[model samples]
Target: MTRCRLCGSTALESVVDLGATPPCESFLAAERLDAPEPTYPLHLRVCTDCWLAQIPPLITPEETFSEYAYFSSYSSSWVEHARVFVEDAAARLGLGEDSFVVEVASNDGYLLRHVVDRGVRCLGVEPSVNVGAAAREAGVPTLTAFLSPETGAAVRAEHGPADLVVANNVYAHIPDVIGFTKGLRALVADDGWVSVEVQHLLTLIEENQYDTIYHEHFQYYTVASAIRALASGGLTLVDVELLPTHGGSLRLWARPEEAAGEPGRRVADVLAREKAAGLQELSGYTEFSARVAKVRRDLLRFLVDAAEEGRTVVGYGAPGKGNTLLNHCGIRPDLLPYTVDRNPYKHGRYTPGTRIPVLPPERIAADRPDYVLVLPWNLRAELVEQLAYVHEWGGRLVFPIPELSIVEVER
Candidate 1:
């Protein structure tokens, strides 16, 4: 992009160019295998002026989320995480049966179900028609719409202002950052809290989690840039917490400027950590491209060697991040014959660009593949436990991001 999406400055520098890849979630059907798939530039750049890392908004959210493929309830660990967050939020905010909560991008009612059980009234604003239907089936009062300024205002007017607004793992999906933030302000009460959970740019660089970069994720944030983004919408950062989900993420607490007092010491401490990691300057990003290249090389070498040795290697999950890694490394079915996922929607589909077949999780046990490459490595602990049966067949698990490592499972 010519100018920074957040600051509107022309001082953007390259962090990494992952070449071109299709929209990661665009799985292919057998009937459409012969049709040409479209791709877009997967380049990430950091703005020297605002320190916000972003990609060109080549794809729109409507194209990706209208009939979303990802169903959040598939991951048991994530659902439990949401449950804990709801319990803690209710206690922290003194929420009761009379309190109201709103969650943006609430996928499949995975989180709001916990809110519903607490006897507190809640609503979910989601764009995808299918997932919204699923949420309604689960008894979550959901409005099928994207969160813009108008939608937020309408929800507030009808339901009254929310006592707490929770937006988890969706801050990076929207191209219009300022407008989305304004919508957040309009939904929340003047004194109510707004909690946003997003992947931290600091952990992304330090851990070499380049696979998470994709077209749907238009921007990345550090606490410093997040403060600026929140300010643009009349919201102020009040407290910060480090979370281990999605490799590493930030849970930022914000409020309207009128009620947002001085930011807590945790916010300043995290800012100091970011500055120490060189995220506020150019030096932090200079070596990321090289590290990303090393990850690509190591993964390809292992897959090729496995194929040459007549040892089968299949993928564990067909997540969006896995598509980026597979497409970037130029892996086809020859290296990874097929992958399996718990989501039934992807059971008979093929991964975008790579065209590798996706099967059910039972296939791993049925086929007894020599190695199962774990794509959604962020859920390592949960998958390791679930796939422990692989040890029965002397199968091992492989993780690609943060470094390439193969682990032996104990039955």
Candidate 2:
């Protein structure tokens, strides 16, 4: 934390300190609820030299991803998103039966299944034993191991060089940014491509998406910083695409330095936008802490008002970001009572720090709560359609991020 993870500099400045909280994915079993739960300081800092926003590496990936709770196939929209990405990537890259595709941190084979359907040889490198088993059961070849330079080279040696390496939503998960990037470089063919999708720091600050910050997410990236990080691993950013997923994200297309030519105009355009937003300097981050504080205050006020007025408020989706929001706002079961998710892995378990009960999706309809707080706001469109049935019982949906707003769903 004292030195930049990407750049070896000691000019890191405070971004926001979210206080102490347990690992966001550490759901408590009924029996383990009595045991002591550990928490770590959730502070974010940006290196002035490289502008890479990061948190301390307090916890290891082995502790969290060894047996992950999240299953990407649980959400129909995310599955469809993966399917579309696979189809487009195959067409764009002219991938065929001869092309070999590999996805790092591939959870439950959600994306690789599409690659398999296309008759393309593919493999999933996942760290989680349980979810990796699920992927293998679904007919996707998966290797249960973490992604390191050694792991990457081993995969290439055994399976041969991959034509396309897809790493979605995992660029920020590792603490060793340079090492992870080098692993990515080693996985793909010398002339092949690597596509990485990560949440953009631009939207995280502008949209008040502070809940995405957690112990597992070691660093956040802007296109400017991302360019530097990619080069550290001997990969060059050739193209960039702005995506709507995860509130906002960047899909960076890269390749081995020798094969990478001039970066596309989109890369320059996005970097221009980041600069215009003042992310490269101190001006962009100066107001983020204050904005985050206001969000916490506003959400707490609404929850308190609802309780006093005798309105029943429950939560939807037991996502990791929800844990950050709950713990940061100091919300307890009394305020939230219970939350529901489609992922049965979390049912009957309690949120790590808030200790809110996670139930099945049917519980919301059966209980008929007056309001359902939507936790995974990034999936707003998908959840809105799924929860439209709440209108049958006069239940409205609540979103707490990007400012608190209540929406009435139509049947």
The per-candidate count of clashes, in order, stands at 0, 0
lDDT of 2 at 391: 99
Per-residue accuracy of model 1 over 1-411 as CA lDDT, tens digit each: 899877899999999999999999999999999999999999999999999999999999999999989999999999999999999999999999999999999999999999999999999999999999999999999999999999999999999999999999899999999999999999999999999999999999999999999998999999999999999899999999999999999999999999999999999999999999999999999999999999999999999899889999999999999999999999999999999999999999999999999999999989999999999999999999999999998999999989999999987
Expressed as tens digits, the lDDT of each residue in 16-116 for candidate 2 is 99999999999999999899999999999999999999999999999999999999999898899899999899888999999999999999999999999
Give the Cα error of residue 187 in candidate 2, in Å.
0.9
Each model's lDDT comes to: 0.96, 0.95
List where candidate 1 sits over 4 angstroms from the true fold: none
> What is the alpha-carbon lDDT of model 2 when measured against the actual structure?
0.95
Index of the highest-lDDT prediction = 1
TM-score for candidate 1, residues paired by index = 0.99
Candidates in order, TM-scores: namely 0.99, 0.99
**Which residue pairs does candidate 1 place in steric collision?**
none
TM-score of 2: 0.99
